[model samples]
Target chain A: MFTNPQYGIFVLISATLLTSVVALLVAVPLGLMAAIFLSEYASRQVRGWLKPILEILAGVPTVVFGYFALLAVTPILRLFVPGLQTFNGLSAGLILGFAILPTIASLSEDAIYAVPQSLRQGAYALGATKRETITNVVLRAGLSGIVASIILGVARAVGETMIVTLAAGQNPTLTLDPRVPIATMTAFMVQVSGGDVAVGTIKYKSLFAVGMTLFLITLVLNIFSFWFVRRFQEKYE
Target chain B: MQTNSPAVGTGTAFYVDNTDYYYGSFQAVRDVTLDIPERKITAFIGPSGCGKSTVLRCFNRLNDLIPSAHIKGRITYRGVDIYDKGVDPIDLRRNIGMVFQKPNPFPKSIYENIAFGARINGYKGDMDELVERSLRAAAIWDEVKDKLKESGLSISGGQQQRLCIARAIAIEPQVLLMDEPCSALDPISTRSVEELMQELKERYTIIIVTHNMQQATRVSDMTAFFNAEPTEKGGKQGYLVEYAPTQTIFNSPQMEATQDYVSGRFG
Candidate 1:
C-alpha cells in the first residue's frame, strides 16, 4: 500500500505532523497561560471552579469537538478566508487545540504549583512583583513540567482520529496551506478501517504500518517527556 | 515607659507596635511591640508554635503572602508606616529581605542566584562585581569561587544557606530577616553563618528567629522571648514575654517564663 498510495505514506505522516504542530502552536501558549493563571494569579475560589471546567473539557468526546468544528467553526473561518473549504485542517487543528487544552493546562498548572513556595517567597522578598516571580522563578522552575505537558499534548493531537477524520477531510494531499482539506495519518487509518476491503490485503497490512509509525512518533515524544520531567525537576532546597 | 527597651533611637530600623496576626479566624500572636535597632542583630527566641517566625515575617511583609493570614496594627520602618495604604509590599520587601529556615537558593547557577535580585531591581552595575561582593559578604565566595556557574543546589547545606544570604544581600536590603537560618545546618556550618551574621550586622539590621537559646546569646545584641498559650478550642496563641538587651534577658528577672527558659527550668 505504501507503493500503491497516490503520494506514498510520507504524505499522510507529514499531514499528521503538520496538523499536530499547528494544533500545538495554538495549544501551548494558551495552556501555559491558563496554567500560570491557575497557579499564580487566580484566587482559590476561581481556581476551584476553573480547574474542574478544564478537566471537563478534557473529558469531552473528540467526536463532539469535531462536530462542533464542522457545524460551528468552519463556516466562521470561511467568512474570513472567503473561499475556505467545508472540511479543512485549520478548523480541525484549531478544535484539536481546545480538545487538548485541559491536558496541557491541568498538568502544567500542577507542575507550576509544585514549585516550592520558598522559591516564590525568595523572589518576592527580593522585591519582584507577582508577574516577575512567576516568569523568572515559578515558570523557570517548572519548565520541565511545562515542556513535558506540551509534548504530551502534541502526542495526543497526532493520535486523535475522530476529530481530524470528521473535520479535516479524507483526502491525503500533501500541502502546507491549512485552508484546504488534507488527510492525516490517523484519518487515513480511520478511512481504511471504515471500508469494505477484505482482510489479508495490502490495505489492511498498510494500516499496521501506519499504526507502527504513529506508535514510534508518540513513543519518542513520551520518552523525551519522561527524560525532561525526571532530569530537570527543579529542587530549591 | 521604662520598659527594658531603650527609647526609639535614631538607629531604630523597625518599630512593630501592638501588632496582632491572624490566620483566617485563629489568632496567632497578640500585642507584639518592639524596636529593632539599626546595624544590630536582634534575635527572637521562643518555643515551638510560639509564632516567633510569624512576628519575624511581619518585618518584611512575608506573611502577607498567606491568603488567610492578616495583620492589624502598625509596622513602621524608619518612621514610615509600611502597612499604610500607599505603601507597596513589593517595595517594602526590597529594603527588608528574608532568609528561610531551610536553604532556598534559586535553582539557577550560583552566580545567577546572586545576580537575580540585582537584575530584577534594574541595577545596571557590573554584575560580576556585585556577585563577588555579595558572595564575599555572605562568606561563601571563597568556597564557591571555582564553581560560580554550578547550580546553587550543588553546594553543601551551609554553603547553600550562605548563597541564600548572598542572594538576599545582593538586593542590598536595609534589613535582613533570617528565620532560623542555621536550624537546617550542621554545627560547623551554623558557626560559620553565625559569624557571618556578626560581620553583616555592621552594615544591615539583622533580625533572627532561633530555637537555640545559645545561638541567640552568642550573636544577638538584643533578645525577645515569646511563649504560646493553649486555647480551649484546641488551638494555641503566641505572645511576646520579654524584650531587652541580650545580657539583661539572660541574667535579670522580669518574666517567670524568661527566667525558666534561659535557666533550663521550662520552655
Candidate 2:
C-alpha cells in the first residue's frame, strides 16, 4: 500500500496502535511490581543504589535500543516462535516497553512512597499483613499517581520512533500480528523526512499531519490523566 | 523500679521486666519494669522525650516497624513473650490494638474504615452489624450512622479519633494501647475519649501515654511516671520514676520526682 498513500496512512495508524498496545502489556504489571518492591520492600541502601541504575535505562540512547532490538532480541525470539520475521513489531514493541519502563516505575515508586506513613501504621494496627496493607491501603491511596505514570508511559511508547523504524521495518500493514513487519506513524514520518521525498509533496505533507495526530493522542491521554487524578484521587490531610 | 500495687485486683495483663529500649546504639529508655493490670486503664505520664509513648508501642510490638529500634529484656502479654522468635507481630497485633497520637483513619469511607480490620482478621459475621456495633461502642454511631459511605477524613478531628477508636475495637482486641490518643483533640473530645475509656475498661485492658497529669488522675486506675535525664551524648534517657495506684501517686507518692511532677513543679 506504499504505492497507494491513503491506504498506507491507515496502515501506519494501526501499526502505531498495535505497537503501543504491546508495549503497555509488557510495561504495566512489571513496572508496577518494580515500583512496589522499591518503595515497600527495599532497604534504604538498596533503594539508593538500585533506583539510579534503573533510571539509567531511561537515559540510554533510543538508537542503541533500536539496534539491540534488531540484532539481539529478534534473533533470540526467532529461535522459539515460528514465522517470526527479522524485522517484527514484537521485538520493537518489547524494547519500547523497556525503554519507557523507568518512567512508569520511577514515577510510581515516588507516588507509593508519598502515601503517609500513618496509613501504613493504621493498617498494621489492624493486623494487616504486609501484602494486604500494600494492596488494600497503599495501592488505593496511590492509585491516581500510578495511573498518571502509566499514561505518561503510553505517551512515550506512542511517540517512540527509532526502535520501531530500525527493528519493525518500513512496512505499513493494517494488521495486529506482532510476528509480522509493521511501520508505525513515527517510522513513516522518519521515512518521509530523510530528504527522499520532494518538498511540498503529499508524502512530505503527511509527516506534519501524522505528527499532529501523535500530538493529539498524547494530549488526550494527558488530559484524561489530569481528570482521572482529580476524579478518583483519595484526599488525605 | 517495679510496682505491683495491692489495689490491682484484676491480675496482671502485661509483665514488662527490666526492659531497655534502644534506637540502634542509643538507649532511649532503660530498665522499665512494671505490671499492667488486666481490665484497667493504666496511664503513663511524663514530659516529652520521656519515652512514655515508646513503652506503650512496645506492648503491641508496633515499635518493631522501626528498623533500628530494639528491646533488650522481656515484655510478656498474658504470660506469652511478645518478642519471642515464634511470635508474629501481625497475629499479636490482632489481640493487641493501637491508636496513635494523631487520628489516622484510612482514606476510605467510614464504613470501610470500621470494616477493614474485621475483614482482615477473618470476621465471618455480618459486616454491616459489626460496623454498627463497633461505632456504637465508640459512641460515634449517632453522628456517623447517616454518612457511612463518606470518607473518614471528611469528619471533624474529634469524630475522626472516635472513628479510629471504632476501627481499633472492631476486631475485638483483648488489649488496646493508646499513645496520647487525646493529645490532638479538643477539650470536649478529650472528655468524651476519657469517658469512653471508663466504659471500655470493663471488657479490655487499656494503657495510655499522656502529657496531661490531670488526665492520668481522671481516667486511669494506675499511673506510671517516667522521667528523662540527659546523657553525655546530649540525648535524653528515660526511666520509670514511680508506679502505683493513681490515688497514691497523686496524693501520697513514694518518690520526690513523682511529687514534683504531679504538682507541676518539675518536668
Candidate 3:
C-alpha cells in the first residue's frame, strides 16, 4: 500500500472531509456564541481579560495539541463510548475544532463589533428587544464576515497535519464512523514525506498530487468566500 | 426662564418637569421643563452642545442605552412616569419611536426594513398591507414601491431617511422624536420631510431637535429655546430658556437670550 499510489486515496479524501465536518460541528456554535458574547454582552473589563485568553488558545503549538488529544481526550472518550479506539477520528477532530475555534471567534468578534452603532440604535428605537436586535440586525449585517471566518476555520481544519497524524493514526479506511481510526490527506502526505521513499517513485509523487488537491479545495473555498461577501455584505456609510 | 407657556395650549403628550440629565455626574442638561402637545409639532431649537438632542432622547429612554447616562426629575408619557421601575423601556419605546439625524436603514430590502419593526412588535395583521400603509404615510411609497426588494441602503439619502421614518411608524407609535432629522438632507429633502412632519402631526405627536432655527419657525406649532452656559467645571450645561408658540418665539420672544438667538445675534 505504501508503494501503490491509488490504493487508499479515496479513503484518505473521505477521512479528511469527515474529520473537517466533525471539527466544524464542534467549532461553529461555540465560537460564534463566544463572539456574540464578546462583542455585545461582555463589559469592557471582562472583554479586556477574556479576548486575550481566547487568542492565546490559537498560539499554542499544534504538536502539543496533537499529544494532548491522543493522551487525554481519547482516554476520556473511551470511558463514555462502548468501543472507542486509541487513535480515532472523533478525538482528533474535536481537538482540531479547538485549534480553529479562536480563528472563528476572534474574526467573528471583529465583524460583529464593526457593525455601526446606529443600526442597533435604530432597532432599539423600533421596540426590538436586545435578542431581536442581535439576531435580526447585528447578525445579518455581520453575515459576510462571519461566513468568511467559518471558511477559514474549515480550511484550517482540512489542512491540519500534526494533530490528525498523531491522534487519528495513519490507517486509511473508507468509513465515516468516527469511533475508529482513520487517515486524512495531510496525514498521508506526512507519512510519505517522513518515510524512506525514492524521489522519482509514484508514492513520493502522490504527495504533490494530494497537496494540489488540498490547495484546490482551499482555493475553491476562498473564491466562494469572496463571492459570498460581495453578495451579502451590508455597506454602512 | 419661562418653563411653561400659555400659548402651548391643550392636549399634552409628554410632561417633562425639572429634568436634569447627567452623563456620570457631568451635567449635560438641567432644569428642562416643557409640555409636548398631542398631535402637534413641537421643535427644540438650540446651539451645539445645548442638549436639544439629549432632551429628545429622554422622551423614549433612548439615553438608557448609554451606561453612564442617568436623569434627575420626571419625564412622563401620557400620565405615566416613563422612568418608573415597572415600566419597560422596550414597551415605552414602542409607544414612542425615534428618527436619528443620519438616515440609518437596515442593510436589508426596503420591504424588510419596515416589516422588521412591525414583526418584532408582534404585528399579527396582514404584513403587506401594513408595509404599504406605513410607506404611504411617510410619503415614499411612489418612489420606492416598485423596488421594495432592493437594499434599503441603495436608495438616495433622502429616500433612506423617509424609509427610516416609515420603519419607525410601522409599529404605530403615538409620539415620534426626531433628532436633527433634516440636518443630513439636501434642501429639497428637508422641505419634503418638513411637509411630511406637517402631515404626520395629524396622527402622532412630533418632537424635533433642530440646529436650523428657521426650520423650527417653519414646522413647529410650539417651540422651545434651549441655551447653554459654561459651568464651573468648564463643560456646558443646557437649560430651557423659553417655551412658546412658534409665532411668539420667532416674533415676540420675552427673554433677551431667546430674542438674540432668534434674531441671529449669537448661539
lDDT of 2 by residue, B66-96 (tens): 9899999999877778899988899989988
The full ranking of all candidates by TM-score, starting with the best, is: 3, 1, 2
**Model 2 / residue A229 / CA error / Å:** 2.2
lDDT of 1 by residue, B1-267 (tens): 011324333368888999999999899999899988988999999888999999988888888899898888898888788878878888888888899998888888999998889998899999999999999999988999999999888999999999999999998888899999999999999999999998998788899999999999999999999999998898889999999999999999499999999998877
Query: Lowest summed-lDDT stretch of 10 residues in model 2 chain A?
Result: A1-10
Put down candidate 2 lDDT per residue, A85-113, tens digits, no spaces.
99999999999999999999999999999
TM-score of each: 0.95, 0.95, 0.97
- Give model 1's TM-score for chain A to 2 decimal places: 0.95
Clashing pairs in 3: none
Q: TM-score, chain B only, every model?
A: 0.95, 0.96, 0.95
lDDT of 3 by residue, A1-237 (tens): 654545757889899988899899999999999999999999999999999999999999999999999999999999998789999999999999999999999999999999999999999999989999999999999999999999999999999999999999989888999988898999988987897989889887888889999999999999999999999997787
| lDDT computed for candidate 3 | 0.92
lDDT of each: 0.89, 0.91, 0.92
Docking class of 3: high
Tell me the spans in candidate 1 whose CA falls farther than 4 Å from its real position. Answer: A1-6, B1-10
DockQ scores for all the models shown? 0.79, 0.76, 0.87
Candidate 2 Cα outliers beyond 4 Å, as residue runs: B1-9
**CAPRI docking class of candidate 1:** medium
